[model samples]
Structure formats: structure tokens, C-alpha cells
Target: MSELARRYALALYSVCPDEQTLEQTAHVLMDDTTLWQTLCSPAIQGQEKARVLARLPVLDGHGLLLNFYRLLAEKGRMTLLPEILEAFNEEVLRQKGMARCRLSCVRAPDAAELDKLRRALCRLHHKQDVIFEIRTDPSLLGGFTLEIEGVRYDKSVRGALSGLGRQLEERRMA
Candidate 1:
């Protein structure tokens, strides 16, 4: 994350004392499908962004939150708002003893499989709260990769091939 994103996230998180409420607001901002679309719409004038944001009832309850949005609009930094929200949510989850886990698989896993994977990951990290992001990539061939923070567990066929190539190169050098 950039310094700008971190600063914005910290400012937004500071406005809501309750962690859950902060998380909820972050989720709303991240999940709102139309937010970026509206901001990018050419028909919408640049100066009108602040006005449009102010009329949103969801953001009106908290003055600090409202001000943050207006500031973002005024500065033309609204495009970074989603990233700011995501970073804020990550920080909140970290404070709550949670880790975000991303899984890339050849196909979508079933509910039971997802639950099992979640349990396994919890055991691996020794943390019960794990946020899972699942993505499908047919090119993976088989197996999946689990990325937690910066560490990655590569169990995919592509990874295995790369590992084998490295091993063969080392053997040739020997």
C-alpha cells in the first residue's frame, strides 16, 4: 500500500471506535459495486463528487467518515478509496487476531471443501479468524496455492514443475 492509502485508511478507521462497525463500513465501501463506476462516469462533473457523496445516507451517520469522503473527492483521490477501505479492513482484522488468506484453484471448491480448507488454515496459522479469497484459474492444472500475508504455499502443478526444474539444474551443476 502507498503512503496515501495508509494515511487515508488510518484516518477512516480512527473515526469509528467500534472495530466491528469500522469493519462493516470498510466492507460496504469495498463491496459497493457502483461507487467506482459513478466516480469514473464522464457525465458526472468533478466538483459534483463531493455533493454526490454527501447525499449518501450510508455515509451521513458519521461526520468524520463523511468528511473523509468529501476530502477524497475534493482531492480527486476517490479512485483510491476502495484500496484504502481494503487496507483499513485488513488492519482491523489484524487487530482482531485474523489473517487474510487467498487461495487460487483450478475450480471453485465446494462448501464442505472450503470449510475444511478454512479449518486447516486456522490450524496452520494458529488463528481461528481467517478471511478466504478464492479465485479460479484453469491454468493451474491441478492443486492450489495459499497466500497468507507475503508467504505462499505453492501446491499447484506449475509450482511443482518449476521446483523440479530447479532441482535438475542444481544436480547438473553438481
Candidate 2:
């Protein structure tokens, strides 16, 4: 993320630290490509952009966020909304003692299995909780590979086969 985006995120987060509000705002901004583009258009005057933002349905009850959007419009930084939202979300997760991880497996786990896996990973990593982004990779054949905090744990059949192949190659060469 750009330093500019981070700074904007920090400023907003400092004033109104409500995760739900920020998440809803992010969704509203992201779901409307036209609105995002319009706000970022240099041809549009700041006053027009601010008026457009002021009339948004999602921002109706979120005065602080509405004001923040208007500020961005006035400052010609509406192009950075995505990065600001990302940084804001990261800050929220960090403050909540939670972490995000990616899990790749042959199949997606059931709720019970996912909960168990989440708890296990939390224990292993000494985190309060973990949120997983799951993906099904048929190449794995079975089992899963988990990536968290820059560390990867490969427990898949493909990984096992690759490791065995490497060992065999090394022995043959030796």
C-alpha cells in the first residue's frame, strides 16, 4: 500500500474506529465502479464530487465516513479508496488479535472441520484467532497447504511426492 493510502487510513481509523461502519463503507465504495471512477475523475470539480458523495445511500447514516469521503474528494485522493480500506481492515484485524491465512486443499472443509482447523492453527501460531481464505486445488490430490504470516505448511500429497522425489534424486546423485 502507498504511504499516502496508509496515512489516510490511519487518519480515518483514528477518528472513527468502528469496523462495521468502515467495512460497510468499503463495500459501498467497491461495489460501485462508476461512483469510484466519477469521484476520481479530475475533470469533475471537488464541489460536484462532494455533492455526489453526500447523496450516497450507504453514507446516509455514516456522517464521519461521509465527511471523510468528501475530504478525499476535495483533496483529489479518491483514487486511493481501495488501498485506504485495505489498510484500515488490516489495522482492525491487528487490533482484534486476529490474523488471516490461506488454505489450499482438494476440497473445502465443513464448518466443524474448519473450526477445528482454525483453532489448531491459532494454537500453533499463538494467535487469538485465525480467519482462513480457502481454495480447492485438485492438484493437491488430498490434504491441504496452509500459508500464514509468511510461513507455509505443506501437508498435501503433491508436496509429499515432491519431497520424496527430491530425496530419491539426491541419493541417486550421491
The top-ranked prediction according to lDDT is: 2
Q: Give the TM-score of candidate 1.
A: 0.69
Question: Each candidate's TM vs. the true structure?
Answer: 0.69, 0.70
Among residues 3 or more apart in sequence or in different chains, the pairs in candidate 2 whose N, CA or C atoms overlap within 3 Å are: none
* Clash numbers, per candidate: 0, 0
CA lDDT, every model vs. true structure = 0.77, 0.88
Residue by residue across 1-174, what tens digits does model 2's lDDT show? 798998998888889999788888767876788987888899999999999988889888889999998999999988888899878887787688888888999999999999999898889888898988999999999999999866899999999999999999999999
Candidate 2 yields a Cα-based lDDT of 0.88
Stretches of candidate 1 off by over 4 Å are 1-3, 17-48, 55-58, 107-116, 167-174
Error of 1 at 102 (Å): 1.3
Candidate that scores best on TM-score: 2
Worst 10 residues of 2 by lDDT: 22-31
